[model samples]
Target: MAEKKFESDAKRNERLYVLYYIFGAMFIILLGALAYRQIFMYGYYHKKGMLQTQRRIIQPGARGDIYDRNGRLIVGNRPVFDAVVYFNDARFDFRKEYARLNKLRKQNKEPFDYSKLAIAARTNVLQSYIDEINSILKTDFVLDADFNRHFSGRQLMPLPLVKNLSISQHAILAEKLRVDNSAVQIYTDTYRYYPYADRAAHAVGYIRPEIEQVDPDIPGDDLRTFSFLGKIGKSGVEKAFEDRLAGETGAEIWVVDHNGFTFEKIESKPPRKGGSMQVSLDMELQGAIEDAFPNRKGAAVALDVKTGEILAMVSRPSYDPNTFFPTMTHAIYNDIRDRGAWLNRATQGLYPPGSTFKIITALAGIKSGVIGPDTVSYCDGYYQVGSRKFPCHNRYGHGEVNLQQAIEKSCNVFFYEHGQKMGIDSIAKTAKEMGLDSPTGIELHEESTRLTIVPTPEFKRKQGSGWSKGDTANVSIGQGDLRQTPLQMACFAASLARGETRTKPSILHDTTRKTDMKYHGAKKLDIPKSGYDAVIEGMVNAVERGTCRRAAIDGVKIAAKSGTAQVMVKGRKLTLAWMIAFAPVENPEIAAAVIVEGEEPGDASGGATAGPIMREMFAEYFKGRQVAQ
Candidate 1:
């Protein structure tokens, strides 16, 4: 019996030992798991927690202001007021409404989608706020169609309830509403403003709303972000200087609660305004030139003779850029498009240079040794090129006329005779050398080289036709396939005034800018002094007592040329009246070009239409100079 009791005691001791080993192994496993979670998995959980609690908001800076050369505001920002609702401020109301709706649904025994119920509740709550706002402000306010989408995706940002409030309306709302702690607050934003309305509209350009991603400088990129819409350039100089004009982006990092509602602002950075710019446009001159357009469809450009600065650029049938801000409707856009107002005519309109191109023809004749100051040609109403006779503007000719007399009288027969003698290649060479074959390198994206044409023998061959003497004669008179923009013609005039082969136009204002820079591989016009003298004398005489007489200002000695070219538009023949000129034969100041599209074939002529406009431009320019002096 004693031996059996001792064996039982030993078995009991063995069981106790097994129990101790199991408890020790379990304690070790628990300690190991604690260390792993506390050290190795800490960063992962911390990041996940951060993502749920933090949110980022991005705001765009105000775009830079654009000014004229005389410090006049061309394009600037105007403060716009908006009534907006912050979703976070209405979170409690949202929850309360959701609970009430869910209870009602349960009592009715109707199946429900949680998302749909939530959306309906939010909409109802928001409608109540809108109703209150409407009652207080006496304005009709409605919820946007994208309310549900905004609630789902961009709850952190304020939703605009009413936008672009007038001064009185904004004042009334600010005085009536409790803005400090209310869900609905007055938000001040900026929209582009045109102080002069449609003046310099094309040069100033327009902007459209664009939503961009958060910049790299902003923090918490991995967190859910809300961005405000920013403006981007749509055309003109705005598009050309987009990078320089765009403002720096600002950011705010907020600590959000479990429901994605901002509770605390951790960091904030105010946006910086974009860089300001002063363009070369002179608004006073621009206005005068725009008002001088004879019709609704035409273009005019004026440049500083020495600097090639674009003083005035006018494309008629222009729009009020202010109408595009805040928002643009389909109707307004369609109207603008239908009226053909969207095109920048100064740089984009391609037309035959007309008789204005005679300047180049005369220069080419002189340069090619075919004609000189003493060269004389007789005109008997028409000139025969092969079997075809091209009629001059005067059915009765000026008899025998010298080079200067031919220009003064605008005798087409003289250019026709001399042009054929110089050949088409010489005229084309002179035209291209004058920068007529390419864009002027202005700070506008609308200017294109492809649209400009300086036709040649090879060019005609490519079009499946051979060059003809008739074509050359037509080209000599600035007809045929020779196409150029008003801007190009203005640049040519400016370059000629400076005695240079090319003029590189600029829209920026820089007093230190040089005009001696080579443009388009063009060199100085190396024609004889006598050649220039004859052309200038003829141009001056034309403005004083000849076809361009209307362009002459009282005390200003102007060198001018007038042109009337025929074109077939939509199977109807129309005339384009043209005038190109430079002022003060002694010291050139401004050079200009004007083109007017005629309603009928014979209704428009260079002197009758474009010459008067040129006179007005010169009048305005000298008037301003006198005031300054």
Candidate 2:
């Protein structure tokens, strides 16, 4: 009996030892796992926790203001009022409503998706707030269609309930709502405002909303982020100076709860306004020129003859830029598009330069020694080229005219005779040297060089055709395959007045900019003083007692040329009336170009249509200045 008892005690002791050893090994393994997690995996788990609890928000800075040369505000920002709800402030209400709904579902023995139920509860709570706002402001506010997507993607940001509230409504909401502590708040944002309305709409341009996602200075690159809508330039000077006009981006580091609701902002940097810009446009001059247009489908441009700076640019059928802000509807967009108001006619509209191109022909003729100041040509109603007959404006014609008389009377026969003598190569060379074949390099994105052409034999040959004397006759009178913009003509007038071959136009204002600097490798006119004098004399005679009589102004000696060209549009023949001029002939100050499109045949003429408009522009420009007798 004693031996059996000893054996049982020994087995029991061995079983106890085995159990302790197993427990010891298990404890050691557990300690090793804890050490690995605490030491080696610290960074991974900490980053994951931070990503869940923290978020960064990006805010765009206000766009800069735009000013004219005279310091008048052309484009600026106006305060817009919005009614918004912060998701964080409504968290408790969301949880309570969700609990109530869940309980009701259970009691009714109905199956429901927890996520869907939560979303419904949130929507109901937001709707109740919107309803309260509607009662206070007498508005018809409702939840947006993308409310669920916004809630899921940007839970930490404020959702706008009613945007672009009127002044009266904004005041009512501000007075009745607890903006500081309530779930609903009044948020202030900016909308682009055009003080002058459509006066300089094309030059000032417009913007559209965009969101920025990346900011280098902000932390937490791997974390989720929320953003505010920012404006980006779409056209005109706004697009040209986008970098200078766009403001700096700001950031906020926020602490969020498990439900992704922001509870505290630990760090923040407010956005700064963009740099302001002062353009070379003169609003008063711009307005005056626009009002001077006699027709609705035309363009006019004025420039400072000394510096190539644009004084005024007018494109008719203009739109009120104010309509584009605070949200543009498809109706307004369609209306603008239908009216053809979106085209900047001054820079984008291509047309045959008409008689205004006579200036180029005269220069080419003189430079090639094909004609001189004393040259004379006989005009008896028409000139024959090959088998075609080109008639003059005056059927009977100016009997026998000198170079000066030919220009003063706009005798087409004289140019046809001289242009043929000079040949197409000399004419094309002069035109290209004058920059008629390229864009003016203005500070606008719409300027294109594709349609602007100074057609030559080479150009015609590439089109699988041969050049002819009829083509030369057509080009000599500025009618065939020769197209230019109003801005280009205006620049040409300025360059001619300054005795230069090219003018680089600019929309920015700089008083210190050199006026005599070479532009795009521009050189002097390369014509003798006698040649320039002859052309100037002819132009002066035209304005004083010739075709451009209507362009004459009291106490102002103007050098001007008028033209009438033909075009076929939609299978209908139309006329384009044009005028190009520079004022105070001896000391040129302003250069201008104007064009008027005819609605019917013979309805428009250079002197009858475009001359008066040019007169008005010059009258306004010399409004308060002393004029040379």
Clashing pairs in 2: none
- Residues 1-629, model 1: lDDT tens digits: 99999999999999999889999999999999988988999998888888999998999999899999999989889999998889998888899999999999999998988988998899998998788779888878887878878877898899888888889988988877865345678899999888988777887788898895578988887888999999899988788888888889999999988877889999999898899898999999999888877655899999998788999999877999899868889988999999899988899899998999999999999999998999999999999988999999999988998889998999999999999999999999999888888768887898856778998999999999999999999999999998989999998888788777887888999887755645334477879999989999999999989999989888788999999999998888999999999987788999999999888768888988999899999999998454211
Residues 281-346, candidate 2, lDDT per residue (tens digit)? Answer: 998888887887865688988989888888888888888878876778999999999989899888
Model 1 ranges with Cα > 4 A deviation: 1-37, 106-113, 179-182, 517-522, 624-629
For candidate 2, the lDDT comes to 0.88
Error of 2 at 308 (Å): 0.9
Off by over 4 Å in 2: 1-36, 103-109, 179-181
